[model samples]
Target: MPNSAAAMSKTGMVTKIHTRIRADPFSAHYELVGKELGRGKFAVVKKCIEKATGKQYAAKFQRKRRKGADCRMDILNEIAVLELAKANPYVVALHEVYETSTEIILVLECAAGGEIFDQCVADNDEAFTEKDVMRLARQILSGVAFLHRNNVVHLDLKPQNILLTSARPLGDIRIVDFGLSRRMDSITEVREILGTPEYVAPEILNYEPISTATDMWSIGVLTYVMLTGESPFLGDDKQVTFLNISQVNVDYSPDTFDGISSLAVDFIKSLLVKNPRKRATAEECLSHPWLNPHPHPHPHRHARSASSLDEPETSQSESEPDSPVPSPDLDDLIGSYLTCPGQGELKAGRDAFSFGEPPFPARPEIQQEVIC
Candidate 1:
């Protein structure tokens, strides 16, 4: 059966491939609505509405090339990681995919709330309340736990990649972006030295073996960023940033991190251990005192309301509430990033249809997993 946007919440917590969907690629059954969310070097994400169900989604479109490039492979790898992560609630959900002559489209669930980075960058002294941080941290750990169990390592874990569906009464938090993800089954260690320099683990730059622990280091960075509104490591150049990480020369002044709880700081210290072997696992992170939700109440704040962030210019009625719904235009989603294809040798007849069923091969163990 085709899953509607209304059914997303239930699906978000379980893994089940939509086998009923087949080759109706590029059909216009759905209506594109709302504003474009964001764009990358090779793809664009637009907030959209499914005409059939009146549901909102973020549609990512990657132009198809006769021959694939590193950018295209990165997108494919992201799809693979999302497939492995589907059983977790803390991970974004993949809805549908379509193909046009020029692009491959992926429909995704849009977290109604914006990026966590938006919150972090709002003010220098701004940071999530301890309760809010713990809620988000727990969600993040759940997603990471699911990824590690599937033998997939998310190389890039940061505030920008962490998204929220609802942040009021403190809303649902989820992790996004899998461009740097890799599977452990094929290669035991990663030496590629990829990922944002500031949040990368020390061993990554030293060309040492990369393990699940590497991601834990990034989680530590995330924890710090959530509490302090600043990244732990920063340098004018990549080389300098890497050098600082190797020496473990991070400076954490009490004045610089005012209002941050000691328990939170201690939790970060345990995970940010210079040695990978000493870093906490995702499961261990859940057990940290900082993440204990029982002692803390969910946050209540005076900041701007979520609906006020960027409400559609035109309002829709409640009876036909979706009547005046806005469309997330393709142009808005892509923004100025859409460029002419780069010159490269073209592979003839490389059939885009050959990708098989949408999402390709599904993991057998997905059925038993629970979204964090």
Candidate 2:
């Protein structure tokens, strides 16, 4: 039965022979080759090629079961969001999906440029100019707007999830990873604390109702990291980081904003507000002067010179713990941040995985009822 093919009743149609059938359905169409692009707790993304067309793709091979039961719903939800937002230029495309008895393979668009965080770190000398940030931010907002229009909320919007099409100067970006995404009605509330500790919104930490504004808050954090290499709410430890986010303890000191433009600062301020209702919507962000500055012959001048700003120094004693902290132990902290009174801690032992070239970070699950 595993390799059998069913025939449909035909009134006046001819059946073709050579109908492909294989014990492993994935191998029948695509050939997985080359080194693994990335790895996670339950999945490995490898480079794959279409047998017929020789087209390349990043195939994410995920196990159907995590502990015992099938955990395919998360993957299915991700697929749904991708299908809804496929037309958006900034969102990564899901080409095809193949499932076997034990695994599900998702063929995704090959992002050659890699993660935006890596690009930002690598380009320390030739830092991104204001125009570059503006263009990238605009494209990201366009993607967010499209997702919002489709009633999709990308709860986890971080630099690691943003990829470039190419390594060229200011190449177009593609937003990947929907592990924490959810589809909801505009008026309904999503109540789950499921996002990276540093970039997650305060509303999420407080276990308050969530909406598209949650994504907007993360966008603000992304903007901060994009402009300044340092994380705005990063604390000495994970718990401290969560407290910083809950308290909205953002450091917009002169040191951090020394060379940054006031308009750009205003744009970030608009999104990072503690009150989710007060945050700027993605559509509104597109019109912000920071993103749509007056055109000038020397547009680069609008962004303060990167050379004038001193890189913020971090002492190991400030961030790292005296003793090594186990990676899995952080799950407890995440559970504390995510769990509310009625909702128990989200099922643990689930590896937070992304669909990038290499697995970046495991995303936390947020439980919410879908309105549609």
Candidate 3:
């Protein structure tokens, strides 16, 4: 018998032996092609090819140290979160990990279609119809639901973070970038001011404990932008934008949403609620009328604004009679929420009800890179 079996017999208890071997060094299996795909503050994603299988992948090279100190914990935390969500269809898959003397490399799936916003811009005239938006929205919700189910909150859920698998009709999507993701239990509350400015939830601005609702709020903003081609709370600058978000000021003028549907407006309102507890859950969002559209036999579909139909505007005095004074420190973090222009669009088919396979070319076997 093996030594482990012999020891188990001697002790009258089964002793498990760990026979797992470490994977070969990443450089041994893949070669960097010198083509840079994306760049960030501390990392650069480059195109790489596998030596043995000839498969393509995006290699994210992150520095092991920052300012002469170890910074691997951030990468490790991201890895842990990705491992828990590896099986999710909407999340980008992590294939391999490599560590070097001064950097860490992550081999990830390649999303050639690029950001959903790019598609929207490419097909400006025929922007994603309501049905197309529904399908994409459902996919995003599925990914978010998976993250929430695993006790992880994806603090950032914007158009920039959502990627398309191909440039074809109704292309599959993958949620990327989990640098701000946090793991939480049932009773634990996370209180960090993170996430992009226009998309950040009100709770984060108010300094309230954050939960899954934070992501839901972003989803609402994303949905609005996709439909109207404009941000609901985006201001001319950072301070105005932050003030708009904190005050929950939204514009639903007929001019802004001339061709939009009422059900779609309702869906956005459900998510953009100032109170986190009132925000819709991912599961609930999946069942929303906008996502799961029901045919209305009526001949005319009226476009309604949020102020006129759903949430009537209230004066600032009436809204915050007893609210505490704002803090300067929180205001500093709020600056990050400034509007990011030129975030491309999501492309979808005209017929929203048809769930046919997209006519996209087969994707290369390369890992996709997520921008942090």
Best by TM-score: 2
What are the TM-scores, per candidate, against the unseen true structure?
0.70, 0.73, 0.73
Each prediction's number of clashing residue pairs = 10, 2, 17
Residues 1-372, candidate 3: write the lDDT tens digits: 112321121211122322221245877899988556665446667778888988777777777675455656656656566667777767777777777777777777766656665544445555777666777787788778888877678776777678766645446667876656777765555665566667888776555677888899999988987787677777665656667887889887788778788888889989989888999998777666676555334422221111111223121110000000111122222111111234442222111110011111142322221212
Screening candidate 2 with a backbone cut-off below 3 angstroms (N, C-alpha, C), the clashing residue pairs are 352-362, 352-363
Off by over 4 Å in 1: 1-27, 66-73, 124-126, 293-372
In the range 88-170, model 1's lDDT, one tens digit per residue, is 66677777767565665777776655557656544443447766677677767877887887777877676656766654434
Residue 302 shift from truth in candidate 3, angstroms? 32
The 10-residue segment of model 1 with minimum total lDDT is 317-326
Angstrom error of the Cα, residue 82, model 2: value is: 0.5
Q: For model 3, what is the C-alpha lDDT against the true structure?
A: 0.60
| TM-score, candidate number 1 | 0.70
lDDT of 1 at 341: 25
Error of 3 at 263 (Å): 0.5
RMSD, every candidate, angstroms: 13.3, 13.2, 16.3
Compose the digit string of candidate 2's lDDT tens values, residues 83-177: 66777667777777777887767777776656566544445465566656767787788788888876678877877677776655446667876
Model 1 per-residue lDDT at 162:
75
